[model samples]
Target: MSHVNAALTPRARLKIGRLIVEQGWSVARAAERFDVSWPTANRWAQRYRECGPAGMTDRSSRPHHQPTKTPQPTVRKIVHLRWKQRLGPVAIADKVGVAASTVHAVLTRCRLNRLSHVDRATGEPIRRYEHDHPGSMLHVDVKKLGNVPDGGGWRYVGRQQGNKNRSDTSGKAGNSHHNPKMGTAFVHTVIDDCSRVAYAEIHDDETALTAVAVLRNAVAWFAARGVTTERVLSDNGSCYKSHLWRDTCAELGIVHKRTRPYRPQTNGKIERFHRTLAQGWAFRRFYNSETVRRKALPAWLHEYNHHRPHTAIGKIPPISRLTNVPGQYN
Candidate 1:
């Protein structure tokens, strides 16, 4: 009698082969019906007759051996070196006598990329602090300095509010507004928050256009000195809030911050600086003319940065407190 040839497991194949031979089915017929080749059917038939189902069972697919796999000891060394030295994968590989690529593999297995480490002080892995870096912010403002006389009269530029072209012959003539002869000049100044380096420009009018041009020049000046501005803070004035000023900030990628209205203390750093400039430079002593006062600004600025001592900065120059080198172990 004829039976069906089925696709079967190894043991079933052996049994099926025996049944096929008992029924005397042709090899080609068994092959076509069982979806197997004639050689496989023939081999199964031989295995069943000689060794039975035990010999027909399938063997494992894994290879018996490999040639050059990395040793476990080397892998352990790589892990130890990476943790102990905090070294990069390439450095760790060099220390452990392995290929750089091998080091990368071990690091990947251990989840130890160089970027994975974090700073304990700031809790930031990649970002830096504003105080730790230069070019974080720029401070700008207009300072009203006392007048200096020239050619037997105070050199006047704009509307001399209380004093403009006066000869204070009296030894006690110190107040410029009561003198009625001295004229004040407004000095527009910009200082880098990171370096405390300052730039001052004398102007009769603090208009929006003047302020914009001064800022542009100040930006270039600071750029030359390795100081750049990521942001700028200023008082809330018509000049700063002008459309042109807003456009300039946008074009220059400067985030602008304005002090609260009527709150001069918000920008007290520059305001205090203005008072210091009036007391220390412009009004420190009597000058012959506005030309003399104007000419002396550069020298005063230099002294302010390099020579003068600042109480806020531990009796050091303003520049010293602003800029610091990184990784200063001492």
Candidate 2:
């Protein structure tokens, strides 16, 4: 295929060559007719004489030989350091006795520029896979965020004021005079593997009962959008391992799968979604109180499901995957 900036396509170059060679037209005249330079016209004509139509196609822009290229052994060393030691370009360069730029270039060629793209156990590129259909699998996890104190936290308010607010909110409970601190908000999340459609809810606890309820609701939410929950993947958290969660999954007919211990990448989808949730909703703006922040979740969730572009799903909103969903356009 011709490049975007190319003056002549393969077919046009062939015609120009025919005009100059077969028809005995002057090189300058063929160049003028084709709106190309005389040298361009003459080059194509010569190529036709030597190699015929195949030579009309674009040639490789790469040089035939690169004398200054790094040696293969040095490149292997850089890749080994990256995979085995998990070193950056500079570190690999220092160990391999090459310039950092050369190390970077070699790593880029080997697709190891980003450490996240390489597996920690092996130096190979991480193999990415997705389910064939929506609801074939769901990734579930909980992101624990510090509850915002009343009158805002240290993020927007000064540290002194934030501390005062925290102290003021830490009230004594019952007969005991011990002050209870403002606890965490557990953001329960469930995301479809294929479509990346996500459902989340903010709760005060990460108990097994809460996890079961959240999963049930998430399944219903997906069902409303024409996606049936077939399986659920989660970390080996206490809530996920509870009998309640097991019974609920059995009742819902969903196979409950758990990630290997200390291996978060096994359930990477929900883990990544938590990062997005924190950036786009939990900490996107300052709230005067926890109540205000809690109220903001539904609106952001709606935007995420129906409007926000998901990179995993072709930069379209997650709702686009559910064709049978009603009022999806709306």
Candidate 3:
């Protein structure tokens, strides 16, 4: 592609070259006609004579030779520090005896400038994988969210008011006596690998029974939409490791896969979906009570599945991936 500020496109350059070379127009006359400098016109004419029309296309701005460029050994060392040590540009610069800017430029050229793009454990670029079909794999996880107090939380109300509400609710009867707090909502989420279609429910606990129930409902939900659950991936949480979860998966005919210990990236789809749920639904608006916030989940989920554009899936809603299902658009 031509640079944004380029005065002439390849076709226009070709026209200029043809006028000056084939038509025998004077360089000055061609420059005046084309509103280009005489040197620019003459350069194109010479290129056309030597290389023909092919030379009219934009060439790379990178010079053929960089004499003062950092040595290959230094470049390798910089990459080594990034991969093995997981060091930032400034830290690598300090170790390599070079300027941080030079290290940054090298890292950028190597596509290692952003640490988020690299795996935390391996320090290598993350290899993202998605199943070819929607039902081939499912990512399941639970997100713990603080329950909103009556009359809203600190986000909308002042901290003083929020603290008072917390104190009032902390020791109330019918709440957890063992650990008295405002209580947490366990958001059980299931998301497909390829389509990113998601199913979630807010539960009081992330126990084995609750997880099994959520998995059953999620499977049925996806089956209703013409997706069969072949595999399910989750972290090594106690609920996922329980006999109940194992028996449930066996009954559902799903291959249960667990992430490697301390490796949450294996179930990253549901992890990322929880972040979206928090931002788009849970914390997006102030609620008078926890019940009010809980009521908003289904509407937000419907919008996410049927209306919101997902970046990973070509900017279309998740339901678009279920092409075999009728009334998907509706």
Best lDDT goes to which candidate? 3
Error of 3 at 195 (Å): 0.7
lDDT at 290, model 2: 84
Candidate 1, poorest ten consecutive residues by summed lDDT: 120-129
Poorest lDDT segment (10 consecutive residues) of candidate 2: 171-180
lDDT of 1 by residue, 99-198 (tens): 9998887777666656445332332333322343445778889886555554333322333521334443333245545644344577998866645567
Clashing pairs in 3: none
Q: Best candidate per TM-score, number?
A: 3
Please identify model 2 stretches exceeding 4 Å from their true place. Answer: 1-12, 28-38, 120-123, 170-180, 324-330
| CA RMSD of each candidate after superposition | 24.9, 3.6, 2.9
lDDT of 3 by residue, 1-330 (tens): 788887777888899899988888999998999888989888888888988989988778899999989898999999989988899999999999999999999999999998887888898888999888878999999999998888788898989888777666644445454432778899999999989998999999999999999999999999987888999999999999999999999999999998999988878878889889989999898898898999999999999999999998889999889873454422
Residue 282 lDDT in candidate 1: 77
Model 2 lDDT per residue over 268-330, tens place: 888888888989988899898888999999999889989999888789998787763454412
lDDT for 86 in candidate 1 is 65
**Runs off by more than 4 Å, candidate 3:** 1-7, 169-171, 174-180, 324-330
In candidate 3, residue 309 scores what lDDT? 99
Clashes of each: 8, 0, 0
Query: How does candidate 1 score on lDDT?
Result: 0.70
Q: After superposition, how far is residue 26 of candidate 3 from its true place, in Å?
A: 2.7
Candidate order (TM-score): 3, 2, 1
State every prediction's TM-score relative to the real structure: 0.50, 0.87, 0.91
